[model samples]
Target chain A: MNRFIARNGPAYAFLLPWFLGFFLLALGPILASLYLSFTRYDMVAEPRWVGFDNYVYMFTRDRRFWKALNVTFTYVALAVPARLIMALVVAMLLDKGLRTIGVYRAIFYLPSLLGSSIAIAILWRQLFAADGVVNRVLADFGIPSHAWITDPNTSIYTLVLLAMWQFGSPMLIFLAGLRSIPRDLYEAAEIDGTPKWRQFLRITLPLLAPVIFFNLVLQTIEAFKTFSSAFIISNGSGAPADSLLFYTVYLFNEAFKFFRMGYASALAWVLLIIIAVFTGIAFLTSKYWVHYENERD
Target chain B: MVEMTRRKLLGTAAAGVAASALVGVPALAATRIRHYWWGNPERDKRTFAVIDLFQKANPGIEVSGETIGWGDYWTKMATQTAGRNMADLVQMDYRYLFEYVRRGALKPLDEYIGKSLMIQDFDKGPIDGGRVDGKLYALNIGANSQVMVYNTRVFQEAGVDADLINWTWDDFAKACEKISAKSGGKVKGADDLALMIEVFESWVRQNGREFYDANGKVAATVDDVATFWQFWADLRKKDVVRSKDKTVILDVPIAESGIAVGDTAMSQFWSNQLVGIQAVSKDKIGAAMVPHKAGGKPGQYIKPSMFMSLSRDVKDPASAIAYMNAWVNDPAITKVLGLERGIPVSQKIRDQLAPGLSEVEKLSINYFTAIQNKVGGLPLPAPKGAGEVRDAFMRTGSDVVLARTSVKDAAASFIDDAQAIIDRAQ
Candidate 1:
């Protein structure tokens, strides 16, 4: 026991700062938010216990809440699948032993690295503006261009494209997963006269299932928590009649703009629950499709 | 192996030192005041100079200046104030003064005034604007009023007369049409209908029906707001004014405004924005009185451009108040800041800064001085949910213009949303 402790003591000591940060910074605020969800805290005055009022109001009276939820889910529905498919396809392309694959990987990973940054969000806003590069291209094609960010019908699509463009991180993870599958598996399938499409469908996809599941869970959580792009592109209030009002953005407005801290806390907790439920569903549903070589034990 | 061990020891020692340092420091050593404001580059330069002056004036005081664009300023202020970590001294706007005061975020200046500060003679309207329920929560830094800014070159090209002081909305529309026709659509007359709201609010106030009642209730009727929107709708249909691009509404620093930058021939803006407009457009830009209804009251008021307020949580209220007094009352600082924050409220500062001003600043100052005697009261204190109300207006207005909802329905919906926001806030 002493030898074991001596061997691992430095490692445990090194992790102490992160653990402390987790408990004090992350966990403390999270717990405070949980407590605040049950009370009225407008920041100016002391908190007053008003159990379930904020949650009740959010679920019942707040149309903005419902609108935000719908927008967020719509975004997740469109963004998550589109992003995963794009990442997977790109990862496969990169894995094909092409020349300058390192450069290709870096180029593909750049947007994801830059994702969630304010500068990139600003760029996204400008790229989709009325006379932006996208619209300028459309204009050159003799098409009448409407204000993409300002138009309610097309604003969400612009965000979807923004989200889809940041598929780099997932692509890198997929590439790693692709690399891990032994070459002998493909060699065996090929020697058995299996076609390229069948080999990909049977071997490549099944092996990549775990990675796909992981990316889906992560991307969905990220999509739900998205705020910067929507906030920046819409100039802090989801523009054109709340078309771009995502859940987190609405929560921000409630907390900061309206000073409804209790309500925002409630919204945050509800969002956590939603994310938890989605993740739980993903895990539960993964058993049928996900092929794990290590599961036999 | 010796080198690796030495390096590892050094790393461990460094980590230990850092950990100990973090644990040992209970509070920051220096007394640092985090000051925040919103302004353009010119204002930023002058503000930093003033900060340097203030630091030199009081050697013991160390101030850290933080600035953001105007659009993000209020949001950051609200968040920080709510979190009880507001800056010691904050540059505030009139729209948020009442809300901040009511929330007890701003320190009342009654005690600090007359002792630590020397405010010159100004009208009771502006002075009272900083007060709520008999407590002076902020100090007026400067004031401005709404005015019509026209491209003189465009007017000349269109053969329209230079004087537009007594021009009615009908006359304004006719002039816009003429300008558009004459310019062959290379220059639009006006950008959008949102500008009409400022005129409507002023008009309504002059008519004894304010946007919000004295009781902080929505006083304007559905028909009142409908008629306001209808005026613009009619003008838009007449091809006199172009509809605002949706994306442009999201952009700030209105000096980038299509009208102010010469994409459109005319615009309505606060008198303070004339300097910024001039900077953007090198061509001839001129000011005129906001066109009023036939035989109607002038309805215009010298709006309190912004205010400087001390935080309630400030450790040293006297020092903060002194700094604010210097910024507002001192002629030297005012000269540096110029009309960037608007015209100075102090007569001494105004006189001192007026002589060396550029042609554009002089024009704005002269135009404002010409109407200062006839101007009405400043706009009323915006209610707690005023931001939401403005957003609701913009949203519903967009809906109406986009034909997603009828004007009447949009107006009614806006009233409903505005009322709900007010009630929720209450």
Candidate 2:
């Protein structure tokens, strides 16, 4: 035992702080929230065990629960593809062209860094308000300005535009992927007199599948967890007829605003499951399309 | 060598114990008090200034002050309460007073009343506003009521007089129409308040009823609310008030709202917010009673803006009470404070600050005192889950304006759903 301890002592000491925090700070609250999910716990009082009551109420009676789920799913479905495709297109544009693309890349990459911050969210609200810059620009074009952010039908679309605006990180990753593609294959296709579009369809698409899959999984999860932008935009009440009621926003309101911590815990677990199922599906489907360059096909 | 080392170790042990005892006992003797609140920069400035004065007055005590912005305050406060580490003094909202008191996070100040509180000159109405379950748990910092705030410059541009004291709903609508036509579409007449709690309370009160009934159900009849909704909707149709896109940002806060930006000439808000809005626009803003029915019991209730209470974790009640005494009853501090919080609760301080008030402060004091007898009792303390119900009001109101739901149906459904939410609290 002494010999084993001596061998592993340095590693153990290195991990000691993180191990302590994990168990004490993280694991403790995780288990506590799990227990509370089965109880009727308000912040004000002791949690009374009412096993599965919160889940039951959520599945059976809560219309807003259903609405929140619908909004989140719609957001994920819209934001993920739009953002990734935008990244890929811009990456392609810079991969073969633009001598000073580094400057442009840095400029483009700035939005993703600030995308989820409260300040950016607030700025987005002002930019899309009725008298804001977007409408003013539209008015100059003689297209007639509309209430883009306030209209329930178009509010979610404005959020999608915000997500799409932050395509920088993904574009960087895509550029790296593009650069790594062997030039010999493209040269051989060119020698064979293949059309540019044909070469792109046959080779580039297949080669870039793995990166696309990676981005799809990552962005989908990130989209599901969106909170700050919607919260700031809607003033935390999911107003304009609850059109901005993202699942996380609703969960936050339940936990903090209404102090129904138990119900919020239940909602949180449901979000975890939803994200897991989508991620699992992406991984399961990757075998069909995502191929590594190292494969000996 | 062994004998010398053992003697030295024993000597150090004795000294350490003595030092610890000396250090710990004085902690008990220090009379240190911790206070916490959430407010703007000016409020923090005035509060610290008063603390400086108090510290100078009593050199024996040490006080610590902490401030947080309003957006994050409640979350931090709840965490502190749950941890049983709340500050000795708490700045609480009237909407949240019952919640804190019910949770036993607040200390009942009845025993210290008239002694530490020095409420001898305090009015009964605002004081009674802080009681829960027949126990005086806290004291209000001041009183306020809902009123219409207007920009006097805009009123002149629209060729309208500044007085709206005895105006009816119809009169308000006509003014909006006239102001809209006169401005040549530059400024809206007034911002919509359809989604606000103050507006709902005032409207129901004007109809000779209250917003919440005896059973704590929403008492504003469906027809009454529908009529008001229809009024705002018709105004929207006429472009008198804001249209759909602009209405989306309706009456957010005084500083950020359309009124501050000169898009609207007037807005309905609590009298407590007078200083904030006036400071925002740097324009001459006027306060008038919310337009009532032409002839009925005036339905403007003077209510407490906020209450200050003792936390359950207080170390020294006397020191905390001393701070509270100076906060409410001291004339020098209240005069410095002016109407930042609201009308001063103490009669002596109110009379003292009266002559020294600016034109804006005088507007609030005169309007509140004028409407003192006209309004009904403060609506029943909103029940638990009241936050959810209040949010529902906004959602339903928006649905009506967006024409997603008929006004009558929306009103009926909202009333039923709101009542059900309140019932769920039981």
State which candidate has the highest DockQ. Answer: 1
Report iRMS values in order. Answer: 2.3, 2.0
Error of 2 at B166 (Å): 2.5
Model 2: clashing residue pairs? none
How large an RMSD does model 1 have? 3.7
lDDT of 2 at B150: 85
Q: Write the per-residue lDDT of candidate 1 for residues A1-297, one digit (tens) a residue.
A: 999999999999999999999987899889999999998877777778999999898888989899999999999999999999999998988898888999999999999889879999999888888779988999899998878887888899999998899999999999999999999999999899999999999999998889888999999999999999999888888876789999999999888777788889999999999999999999999999998978885
Write the residue-wise lDDT of candidate 1 on B1-426 in tens digits.
999999999999999999999987765534567678998787788899988887877776677899998877877887787678899989888888887787788888887667887763655667777888898887887788898888888888898873576677778878888888998877878766543456667767655677888788888778877877787777777666765563236435567665656777777788888888887875788888876666666678888888888887797766677677778766666777888788877676777886698999889888887887666766578788887787777778877776677778887877888888987877
- Tell me the lDDT of model 2 at A185: 92
Which ten residues in a row are the worst by lDDT in model 1 chain B?
Answer: B243-252
Clashing pairs in 1: none
Chain A, candidate 1, TM-score of 0.93
Instruction: Report per-candidate DockQ.
Output: 0.49, 0.46
